[model samples]
Target: MNGSGKDDKQRNRVIAKNEAERQTTGDIRVSAWTIVFAIIVGAIAVYIVWAWLHR
Candidate 1:
């Protein structure tokens, strides 16, 4: 058999690995942003409730 088959498999494996790493890093950034927004919203909610109760 020609060696072309092994080379194709190796190329496919590398492509898949790179895609996986890209997706993982993308998810991490999204998760960080989500956490930041969640904290901000929670703080705003607490402020609103405190102001409502005191006023």
Candidate 2:
């Protein structure tokens, strides 16, 4: 409403560029316990499906 279409496009481009830069520089940190828990849950799910199919 306040600005023109070109201004909106430029603002959107700047926002997208910043987001891209942040993602590239970001570090993903996952804890060991989280990984272990996920694996345990996945194994349980697989076991349940296997038991269901066999029985």
For 1-55, candidate 2 gives per-residue lDDT tens digits of 5579889999999999999887765533345567788999999999999999999
Q: What digit string (tens of lDDT, one per residue) describes model 1 on residues 1-55?
A: 5799999999999999999999999999999999999999999999999999999
Model 2 earns a TM-score of 0.45
**Which runs in model 1 stand beyond 4 Å of their true positions?**
none
52 Cα displacement, candidate 1 (Å): 0.6
Q: Distance from true position, residue 34, model 1, in Å?
A: 0.5
lDDT of each: 0.98, 0.84
List runs of model 2 lying over 4 Å from the truth: 1-30
Question: Candidate 1 at 4: error in angstroms?
Answer: 0.8
lDDT of 2: 0.84
lDDT of 2 at 38: 97
Worst 10 residues of 1 by lDDT: 1-10
